[model samples]
Target chain A: MQIIFQIIFSLFAIAALGLVWRRRADGLLSKHSALWWSIIWLAVLALAWYPNSTQVLADILGIGRGVDLVTYCALAFLFFTIFRLTIKIESLQRDITKVVRRDALEKNNI
Target chain B: MIMILVPAHNEAKTIENVVKQLLFVGDKVVVIDDGSTDDTALLAGNAGATVLRHTLNRGQGAALETGHTYARQSNADFVVHFDADGQFDFRDIPRALASMKEKNVDIILGSRFLGKEQKIPWLKRAVILPFARNIDRLFGSVSLSDAHNGFRVMNQRALNFIQLTQDRMAHATEIPQLIRRYNLRYAELPISVSYHEFGQGPIGGFRIVRDLLVGKFM
Candidate 1:
């Protein structure tokens, strides 16, 4: 189980690095993206490599277990991603509405 | 010119009649057919209304915003946001306009709770309405007798400030909050609205609450 976890964390770090490179190549990566992907994933890799470190951090945070702390952190990240996606979708909807409105107005112009 | 905006979704049956009635009262009547699969746009256009269509069904609030945008661009003096369900009396429109003029107010909102002629169903009046009223009170400082009533008229000043963002039924709640936010002078006049089969019942109330809760984040 520990070996499997280590492999998964290594793969996630590689994937995050790949994404940052792709985004940078496309000129779509902001400073925030660069920092978030690099810093967070590197930190995650560190935690995965030294599993005992999570327990030390968890103890400081008053969490019962290292796994529980990791779970909470994962959940928080998932929620933040969901929130960002929702806002993006809403903005796209507004843009579509603008285009539709413009077309409708031109069609019915009198 | 007075621009009457009717945001319709699959309202092919009543759009013509609503547009015609509104045309009689206002200078120009425009229908924002919110992606109706039926002949809503065609019928409304044929009935002499400037029809706008959404490619996808966004919602009533979005349709209303589209109509308002067009109205503003056309330099409309006053904009009346009417329903395509044919529930409101067109006769009251002139009265609403007159009241706005008399009071020198920016917005004239129709209130079924304020008038005797309106026969709102018992469940809606007793349960859904009071709940909505309380929610509106909690959301904003603006106090209105009927917060969900769709019949409303806004002058240029009111339209310029209040930009609706909710794409669904939550716009009703947002409107009152806007009045409080902008500190716009508004009056609630008693008006009659008929309960239709699709627009009434417990399901409708549930839907309203659900959409409003969802609208909080958006």
Candidate 2:
């Protein structure tokens, strides 16, 4: 059963890597973003193939289990991603304001 | 070239009167109708104000920034930011400008806490404003008597130096911070604010703080 689960996880990681490659090819993802996604999925693939590999690092970090360490890292990564997206949205809003402001000023030229 | 910049959003009920009252005190009154579904732009235009319309409902801060841009382009010597809800007294416009000159300051902020007492709501007068003032002091690094008064007069130096990027109510706090950072001379003058309704409750205060924190840390 454990081997079957590992195979499923590895297949999922490979599928995600393929999706990332297709997106990068289509110019939908920036070069840096595609590279970052590729690295993340590659790490996931390594963990799926060697499920016990995380145990050494987790034990060094004082975490009880490898799976627990992965969960904690995933949550931290998600939070950081959210923070970056929020900042991006705010800057985009400011840019939109600038465009709208310029348009309004131009139309009402005195 | 003293221009009064009024940022209005769906305040058609009072925009006309506010524009006319401002025109009485300033050379030009420019009302930025902030995507109001109502006839705010039309009424302000009819009332002899130079009306600038935003196609979408960008918050009050965005509207005020647009007004500042207009004032800058028009080569305005001074600009006064007045509320569109008719809460502020137009007669204080000259008083603020005069205070700016007498105090040798570039910016004069209207303070409800100064001079005579105003008819502010009890909750705001007691809790929200004081809390906001402390927060402004912490984040903006300026200790002000009234931290969020909409009525302010700024000279050419301030006009050129202060650029508002906060696209919401947080601009109030941003203004003082800019004054401090740019080393612009500023003073607080006594002004009256008649609260017809409860303005900016505790929730609004929290949102301003949130925006300030996000803009600062994020």
Candidate 3:
């Protein structure tokens, strides 16, 4: 029963990430960012499945069967934050490149 | 009103002087300090410009985005990009902006080749300029002698029109690409670059190439 629950939870997590990526996805970020993030998500899933890792995490947090739930939530938040920051930085870099090119056009093509 | 956005990192030695010069022309100057461990943000802010900080040193491109977002949100009628490295003369800004207005162009770029006395490094003329123009002529129709310059003014239309999907040095290469892509009116004026007494290498060769390639994947 526990194994089935873990599998279902893993599938749901992936589905949610897919939804976010599909809805707001921009050209190649959808590909690059997803690839990195999925690796992180896979690690989290591994931690969730490891019985000793789960018990130790639960003990550290002083929780019960709640370790699984807490781990999943924490992993999701961590992955999401890093993913968002990467995209933000990508857009920021794009802005500078645009400005320099615009300057070039003004002097020559104008 | 015009807003000046200077995106800098670890430029403490030069940013203050640059801010002081920019102050002469624009209504406001904003600096995006991209994870500068040095006193770049403090110096720029102390020089009477508003400063925005990034917690990590993402890159120069990241810094520019911060400045642009701030300028657009402030509703600037026109915005110009400034370098924190203190290379260009901002007094020329009035000329660029006026030309932008007169031509009804979305943006006006500066070219060092226009001025007979423009002081620039010989290597740039020999190497980077030729390479840049060739790239422009072959893979793109930008038709400009230079594409990596940082001195420019974007009218609110072009300011809003710019879609900088590129997040790296490719943005420098892509400016003309995007301009043509967006069908925005553009003008380039004669401008010069001052190589520091201690010259830096061709500004961003590897990173620009890498980023441009990475952008293709993105």
lDDT of 2 by residue, B1-218 (tens): 89999999999999999998888899999999888999999999999999999988789899998999888888999999999999999999999988898999999999999889778878888888889899988885578988799999999999998888889999999999999899999999999888877878888988888788779864
For B11-98, candidate 3 gives per-residue lDDT tens digits of 9999999998888998988887777899998899899988777766656555666566666667889888877887878888998988
The digit string of per-residue lDDT tens for model 3 on A1-110 reads 98897787688767756764664475545676677667666665675477466676676776776567566767898897876666666666556555643442232221
All candidates in order of lDDT, best leading: 2, 1, 3
| Model 3 bad stretches (over 4 Å) | A1-110, B137-141, B197-203
TM-score for every candidate vs. truth? 0.87, 0.96, 0.64
Candidate 1 residue spans exceeding 4 A from truth: B198-218
Ranking by DockQ: 2, 1, 3
The CA lDDT of each predicted structure is 0.85, 0.90, 0.72
Clash total of candidate 1: 0
Q: TM-score of predicted model 1?
A: 0.87
Whose lDDT is higher: candidate 1's or candidate 2's? Answer: 2
| Shift of residue B162 alpha carbon in model 1, Å | 2.6
Better of 1 and 2 by DockQ: 2
Q: Global lDDT for candidate 2? A: 0.90
Query: Docking quality tier of candidate 2?
Result: medium
DockQ list for all candidates: 0.39, 0.65, 0.06
Residue pairs in steric clash, candidate 2? none
At residue B19, give the lDDT of candidate 2: 91
**Clash number for model 3?**
19
Q: Is candidate 2 or candidate 3 better by lDDT?
A: 2
